[model samples]
Target: MLRYGLVVFIALLLSGCEMFGKKDIRLPIDVVSLQYDPYNYSMAELDRNATAACIAKGGTEAVAVDNEINTESVRWAYMNFNCYR
Candidate 1:
């Protein structure tokens, strides 16, 4: 009896509930960390950090790289700054 019931269940599942064709099912997996590449577009903090670096080097903030810092460096810099504060 159990085997017959199991067979019916399997048949129904394979038949896509007798409605649509086989449905695509997505499964959730555990993620440890998700990191996305940072864009090169300049934001306020990028200006600040690079400016601070410039000032520490005895140069004006305007002399700082006028481009977006890579995302990984930005994250690391932000993480470091946050720890000190």
Candidate 2:
């Protein structure tokens, strides 16, 4: 019975670390959103523009994070990036 209690106590202590250890720790991600008219540009063009814009703002790597198109109207793209010194 004592051995079982010690095992249960250790398990609970480790589980607590798993639950609370990550508090307030996060990797910063820079996000940029842009809008364009699909009639004037293609998705590839928009991606290039977004990447350039992100790098211009001091980001090292840029990736297309999301996209939305209003087939009747406009297109939108979102870029995510990380900046480095």
Candidate 3:
């Protein structure tokens, strides 16, 4: 039982660290809904980073579309942005 709990804890910890660096924004992704794990990040930060990425990809503007927070299963939040060229 104790071993199982420890394993679960480690798994969650590693998963949460998935966004440790700028891996999500390293590539030139499409100007669509950019889903991010808001576990240790702020919405403003996410938006700023995403917009910057868009601009770097030659987008004139990056407007946020929908911002929703899910409280049900697989709780998560999305930062949708429409990139205008």
Better of 2 and 3 by lDDT: 3
The lDDT for every candidate, in the order shown, is 0.43, 0.62, 0.70
Kindly list the per-residue Cα lDDT of model 3 for residues 1-85, writing each as its tens digit: 9999999999988887885743544332457566677565676877787778788878766777766666464546677787766
Model 1, position 12: C-alpha lDDT score: 82
lDDT of 1 by residue, 1-85 (tens): 9999999999989787667865655332211111223553344655566456545544443222223346555543221111110
Q: What is the lDDT of residue 85 in candidate 1?
A: 6
Candidate 3: residue 34 Cα off by (Å): 2.6
Off by over 4 Å in 3: 1-30, 38-40
Ranking by lDDT: 3, 2, 1
The segments of candidate 1 whose C-alpha lies over 4 angstroms from its true place after superposition are: 1-42, 63-85
Candidate 1 TM-score versus the reference: 0.28
Lowest lDDT 10-mer window, candidate 1? 76-85
lDDT of 1 at 55: 52
Best-matching candidate per TM-score: 3
**Is 1 or 2 the stronger prediction by lDDT?**
2
Clashes of 2: 0
